[model samples]
Target: MKKLYIFVLVLLSWNLQGQGLPGLGAGTTPNNKPILHGKSWVAITGKPLGASAGATIFNQGGNAVDAACAMIAATSTMWDVLSWGGETQALIYNPHTKKVIAINALGYAPTGATVDFYKSQGMDYPPQYGPLAATTPGTPGGIMTMLAEYGTMSLEQILKPSMDLAKGYPLEAQTANAMEAQKARIKQWPYSKKIFLPHLGEEREAPEVGEIFVQEDLYETLSKLVEAEKNALAEGKSRKEAIYAAYDRFYKGDIAKEIVRGTREQGGLFTESDLANWKVKIEEPLHVNYKGIDVYKLQEWTQGPALLQSLNILENFDLKSMGYNSANYIHTLYQAMSLAFADRDFYYGDPAFVDSPMEGLLSKEYAKERAKLIKEINDPKIGPGDPYPFQGGTNPYSDILNQNKEALASLPADQLNSSLDPAFIEAFQSGTTSVETADAEGWVVSVTPSGGWIPAVVAGNTGVGLSQRMQSFVLDENLNPYNLPEPGKRPRVTLTPSLALKDGKPMLAFAVQGGDSQDQNLLQLFLNMVEFGMDVQEATEAANINSYQMQSSFGNHEVRPGAIVLRKDTPAWVNKELVDRGYQIELWNKTSGPLNAIWFDWKHGSFWGGSSDYGDDYGIAW
Candidate 1:
């Protein structure tokens, strides 16, 4: 009788709140992982070893910037879907400046990477793999720049973790399996075959799980960088100067010469000048104030602004009143995202090369205008809006828009559908890894570093994998005039890192690892916390909807209009409503995440880190 009475009282409490589960205020929530508590610092990333690197830095008296650099190096060395030669995109919140800054380390197209060059080869877009797709390396410059500008540690101290990993580390199952799966492609590159396939003639050419995976060439390259920094420091150069000394060696010294020679050997288009001219830019990030919280993201060069635009449009709706994951709420979020992503697909690109109407695109009035287009159903034919008029300029691409509409109208019905094949799914969900770090001193960092996955083209004896980001560029202007392939132009990429501030202090730092689905998942994660009242952990683990309306930024750039993915646990009635509303529903066991986030518990003066249990994501707080 006592147990029955207690259960009845609990049920009554939930009924009184008018929701299925008590969210943020609840004593507990359903989760596979507990919220990490930290008083001094927290480090979270795609792998356990990566987080360990950050923790090591933190323990060595290094601040968040130094720790973040160490984790980036460690992960890059570990080949966690990235390499030393891949590009890096980051958002760092500096405690001293009380500002969030963007790091643009994206590699650019080489000298001969012209549209005509690709067209001469009978290709509409750049090839998805191999030497033809390589770009000027950017990750090395990015790390050195950040360390010199904001970090307190020396280059040697920051790079020690990666150097150790480069010598040898027990290979994990997933990476080993990936290498084995793509061994044929890996064997195509002589240098890659020499390093990755230790057992060439055996049944398994790639290293097995628990085997010591070594990269002697990469270790030597790292040692050379440290030697440069040490030589400069010994000569009485300042810490910043010493770091730049290492940077110079990588870009203009022996390292650069070797990279150029090796790349040319693989039929790549790299020149010494391409590597020497590349520099990392530390610039102001773009942000929007949503319901009193400021959300920051990288600029037009990345697809980040789309999330800001989606937030601006969503502000017009009363989300909480619609109930979490309800048909109405899902439909509203999907429509807003569709509107924003349509613009992203057509307009977002390298701002240095194109005059993207960002001032108007991010305008609240423009969002209000876009919001008015949202109806009770999804719009498969959704296209970019005219933001030029909002910014008081005339539309220069009006004729281009007309031609796009005509092209869409001419497409066959079957071709418009989503391909469920393994290959297509692989392209659609092309992966990256995220890094999130925070400390008691108020420094915060979020990074989405990617490019070199498995089967990468290793540049001769350097053991460094070249970036395959060139495939993101379109050869034809009609597809995206702003993103056409050209020499020295950075390809518009999917890498984005998010930071939110409230009351002039850090509120959240979050990022995810899906290709095109990154911002889509991030948008929902933000909403789940602010609107639905879920705590950071709940928000990170929440099942979110995914729309396949936007063109992919990877292989073939396919778009599957009206298709949406829902979690298998979605209510039948809600699923039925969505199908009736014209959505081609696809049930997924997990809709979108692997999201990693950190929330500032101001009231408690501590950090609450959330690492979703879906993937290899891990977090360590102390």
Candidate 2:
């Protein structure tokens, strides 16, 4: 009541003019540093405008889910890579019900995307970019669903910020950098080049850091959806029905048809059925008790469970006693994550298609048995451990695991070409957005929205986007236990979001955007906060480390066994020690990008917003 009391006074003094009461709290922080904190409903989002949009929503009587929808709307429009026509996943915690709901909006393969289709094309795998790589988008439906089920605001209100952003907005430094880095992909599509490569100072180039970038088509696209909702309202439909009307405009109406026409005309194998049949699945969230704190993650379809599995193994050790970021700590994280990710490479996929052995995979007893396999020295390769065998059941993935091992055994490490080069990593580094929100009433949401970008051909004249995530599917069914290309099956993605609860109360929500780095960076940031006693802001500002030891989820599925990267600021001795231990170590430049999270102090009835100092990450707490 005390913190809430102070928050009321702050909000009471606040207005809609973008002004703040300074003495009451440090409501915001500058870029390239820590972050701001306060005792109120807070928004930590990918960009400043997104955060501001959330703050406005919160002040206007919206709940956390409403604010989350508003922030994502702004994020999708501002960053082309973290697009409107993309994939998304979210974990929402309901305090009253003590239930955490998982929203999986990641797109699925079109009916035409199948092993036989790839075989007929003489393609070993789905191409990494363009129309050939598209999947049925899920973001539009996901956002609308969130608004319909959980949000308080209407589609028109939440979408207003995005409409403004798409029609015209100043290009931030982060987007400018993305435009420059993904220049080649942008050039491949006239629609993208026209939007992103606007002429600056008499030269056609990536927009200068603060120049304006406009997407007239995108503005029209979003407006059309809103028009549908408004028309439904005018016809005396319920608010929820109006939201559904808006969703239909994108999923089954003219927009969806236009998207199908555009992609198929550009050689994409898609039909209206793919878009109409698309639906976001809501399921129970996966949870694990980590050192008495409950942690929630997406299911096995994502690389999410790896974080929990790693926690289970690491729980056996005294991490604080080992000293933070020590050689022992780093080695242990590497080994544990390696083992979990081996399982990820072999077992993680659309659960509808594969038996993931979820019961054993999440059991503490299984983690104990698997921990015995971690050696004192690092192992370049590990097992897709037989979770079912450990749990005294039949292992469904056994045959596929054995086949994958045999395939790798036949290919020498030196001859294996990886797709995780400078260019590929740079493309990922350019994209994605995350939002974390917590309201005074205790509703919380952590969402990681990603995929659609410049590389994919635009969706016809609709001024919309489609995902290139079909490449995440597998070519050889034997090598991919759960990720074989199948109609209506979601791809095994790296888009994992994390939620933390203290003593049965929701405490923290977080997500990141570096493809495979999503889990690694998030795992590190979580440990930084919970294990090393760092605040949310310092946890993000802290230097990061990552590994590419597992076969990538993206194109080519290359394995960079035992490869590890650390930021230069990490102690030189730690790098030398890891190298001495036979792990391939590369120094990362500026580590990871724009990781966002929010922590709620239930005891104080306060909320704290945090973000990485990198990119355009910003926080608003008032």
Per-candidate TM vs. native? 0.97, 0.90
The global Cα lDDT (0 to 1) of model 1 is 0.89
Candidate 1 to truth, TM = 0.97
Candidate that would win on lDDT = 1
Model 1, 383-468: lDDT tens digits are: 89889988999878989988898887787766677545667667877888999999999999999988877878888788788888
What lDDT score is found at residue 198 in candidate 1? 92
TM-score of 2: 0.90
Q: Give model 2 RMSD, 1 decimal.
A: 7.4
RMSD to the hidden true structure, all candidates: 1.9, 7.4
